[model samples]
Target: MIDAANTYEALFVPALFQQWAPMVADAAKIESGDRVLDIACGTGVLAREAARRTGRSDRVAALDPNAGMLAVARSLAPGIDWQDGAAEALPFPDRSFDVVVCQFGLMFFSDRDKAVREMLRVMVPGGRCAVAVWDAIENAPAFAALVGLLDHVAGRPAGDALRAPFALGERQVLATLFKGAGANSINLTTCKGAARFSNMREFVEAELRGWLPVMGVVLPEPQIDRILAEAETILARYVTADGLAFDISAHLATCRRP
Candidate 1:
């Protein structure tokens, strides 16, 4: 069995999530000697970036509910503290971190408001928190088409699993979430990025093998083949000379603990 976390780090991170780490880290203004926490740190892409900016791995900690993900993160950056936890209930002393960042994680949190509150709860007064979430499904045409294809072929659960990441894409809804969580001086910015895969098949396979299983929606090999075949046609326009490339965007929400 190929570990989903390993696949996520190998395929999804480079294809999509890796580029946003710097943006989220910058949004939080991570500085040397500052303690940082990356909530829902899947494979710790942003957490690694935080460690780089802070200039000390000991000062950076990453937490994720999935132990497999944490295992991969720990292997990649053994110096940083890796914890197994969820966003709604973080396991740390209050005011433990100077900066907190979550890259492309806020949308899937079980209790988004409580998660934000927990993020604020762990930060020192005036500490920075930055979260990155994908923009609406419509903004990313390739994903939008994939969702439709999944809905048609694999059914609603499969499609919804892919769609879940974009649930909190709306700007007003995100701002309101932080406000309800009692975060101060909240700001939201949309950052544009790109998703690059070696080919259309690889793009589709990454989601099929790396993401959907984690969401509890697994398709049989035949269906996977069918989806891949259709995806090549559906997503043809995104193909480039080097590979497949498409525009991807995310909303970065930044705030401070009061």
Candidate 2:
């Protein structure tokens, strides 16, 4: 898997995240002078967009548990405040932000309820919080194929995480959590979008290098090659001359702090 900042920035970001960050930011309703925090801000895509909307970097902060992710985030958007932290135990004062946004991060938190409460704690009354989570793995056919392949090859290590990101996809359950966190007027919306990779090979390469779940599985080269070859056929349906194009789904929930 790839580790360098440039490779991740150039390939992985555009392939999976770049297309979705703005959608999350827009739902947050970030405005000028608003202090925004992006929880689990992987490469700081949403945080950077918040900073741009605010016309100042200091007003935008990003937090994540992974040093590698924070490192890449810091290098790309050095102007913003990037903290090394987790979603459950955020290292910030209560009512510290005007908006809280998380992009495909809620499902990965160790304690999603605690994380939701923390997000509400950090936002001012009447402020907005927007969260995005992937829909069920089945809805994203490409990922379904990938995870199925991982399971077929390595039991379950990689496949588990691939499934975790889509765990909190149920609308009623998500809404209940937000309401319990003291957020009112919660609006949950499902969005279907295209996930594009430059090509099938690049898609495989990016997942091998950039996706933690995939890279964490330590298999011999030949075994890995075999897995990749198998995955190729499974994902072949999504590939075109331009690249791999397929419909992916996510749920975006927006709420106002009480």
Candidate 3:
């Protein structure tokens, strides 16, 4: 496992989080004066959103195991209270937050159950804990196509395998995870967004410099370049009257502790 200290910002910051904000905010239900905690708050995307809703009276605490990501978070969203901590072992005391949110971070945890339990432990009674994860490859055709084309062209291990944990989009698993963590009610919902690129080049550029770094473990430089060329070809099909439109889908799970 790569140290959390090293791999967050470049791997997950702008790329993964650009699609997560809306999903998390909708599921977490940020309200005025609500004290919230954003676990794995990569660059403080969710934290900033929550803080905006909470205003000055209340606070939004953003926590992450990655010091690099936390540095970016502090710079990007200074109003948020940024802290260094892991999801499985949160630093806060029990019942510290009215809402605890983890966006795209739950899947990376080594101990998913313990992380869920820790999230609940920090939430006040009746408070909410919400998590967002990516759907399976088939459900996200754009990403699926990208991965397929990349692996085919590069003749390398698929990058999507590294992202397997986030594919747990089933409602049953979401419910069970929360219930086992002492939550009384669980709600699951899906959010879909469109990412428009002028052409395949821009799309490839975004992926290459963005979350593509995360796949470096599986995709080397030569392989990534080959994949990019193939990705451009496949994405050309999606370019129509407007532009290249790729669908981004996420599963949002919200649970309320008894």
TM-score list, all predictions? 0.98, 0.94, 0.84
- Residue 202 in model 1: shift from native, Å? 0.7
Which residue pairs overlap in candidate 1's backbone?
none
Q: TM-score ranking from best to worst?
A: 1, 2, 3
Every candidate's lDDT: 0.92, 0.83, 0.72
Residue 84 of candidate 3: its Cα lDDT? 84
| Candidate 3 ranges with C-alpha deviation above 4 Å | 1-20, 153-158, 215-221
Q: Write the per-residue lDDT of candidate 3 for residues 1-258, one digit (tens) a residue.
A: 133323444444444466677668768888888899999886677888788778842388888776666776776667678988888999999999999988877877889899999988899999987888877667767766776775666444555643454557676877788878788678888888666665666566555554445444444678668766677667777786765776777788898878
lDDT minimum window of 10 residues, candidate 1: 1-10
Clashes of 1: 0
The digit string of per-residue lDDT tens for model 1 on 81-134 reads 999899999999999999999987888888999999999999999999999999
Cα displacement (angstroms), candidate 3, residue 102, comes to: 1.5
Better of 1 and 3 by lDDT: 1
Looking at candidate 3, what is the lDDT of residue 221?
A: 74
RMSD of 3: 3.6
Candidate 1 Cα misplacement greater than 4 A, ranges: none
